[model samples]
Target: MTKKIVVLGVSGSGKSLIGKNIAEKLGYRFFDGDDFHSTANVEKMSQGIPLTDDDRKDWLAALNKLLIDNPTAVIACSGLKPEYRAMLRQGLDDVAMVYLKGSIDTIWERHQKRDDHYFKGRGMLESQFATLIEPTEEEAFVIDIAQDADAVLNQALSLLSES
Candidate 1:
């Protein structure tokens, strides 16, 4: 069985909501990658500063450790760059990546509706899209996010069940 599932997407793509639902369905622990960020990283994002690879090094390492420690977990993370994704899967074979895909315009509208999050604004979304390398079909279970949330969750569960 796939023990580690990482939900990958930019902000406003519903990684957290989808990941949490998936975890609940599978009886696995759920983790929001944003919560593991250092105080400095959160501060930078709150100030509208995009995190560089250097800024993410430690954060990614910590997430990788979380995967290593947990036998069954669903983590919502912005696995944007290829290297970042590769690092996330290092030494792990029973891992599954679910990439929630949507257009910038589609996600931008969602981003606008959110108010309780620190990672807000169109600029931040643009920065994430710019950095995103988009995992290939071979690399992840890709799910379209343009549909309703229930449909998206069902599709994810179906795909994961097959794996």
Candidate 2:
């Protein structure tokens, strides 16, 4: 079994929910990467600001350390860029990535129903999509999220088993 897993997607793509489910099913610790963000980052996002690479440098390092500290855990993170994913994987060879894939319209609809999140607005979502560098098949299990969340979770679990 892969001991370390990161659920990757833009906001509103269900990374947190799916990551939690994966951790529960695997009997592993769950960490929401959002909780590890700096106060400044959170503040910026609350104001509808898109974070740059430099803004994420320290955040990624902290998440990498979290992975190092907890050998068996699942994390929810945006990981929009390849370099960001690389940073998250630093010093971790057994890490697995599960990307929740969905169309903007689909995710936007879902985002509308969500509540109390720092990240908001269609523009923010668009910025996230613009920043996204999707992982290759070899790099992550890509689960289509146009289906129901339950189906998406089932598919992710099934893929993990196969891999």
TM per candidate comes to 0.98, 0.97
The reply for model 1, stretches above 4 Å from the true place, is: none
**Global lDDT of model 1:** 0.93
Show model 2 residue runs off by greater than 4 Å: none
Residue 160's lDDT within candidate 2 is 82
Go through the candidates in order and give each one's C-alpha lDDT: 0.93, 0.92
Q: In model 1, which range of ten residues has the least summed lDDT?
A: 112-121
- Cα deviation of 109 in candidate 1 (Å)? 0.5
Per-residue accuracy of model 1 over 1-163 as CA lDDT, tens digit each: 5889999999999999999999999999999999999999999999999999999999888898889999899999999998999889888888899999999999999988888798967899999999999999999999999999999999999999888
**What lDDT score is found at residue 131 in candidate 1?**
94
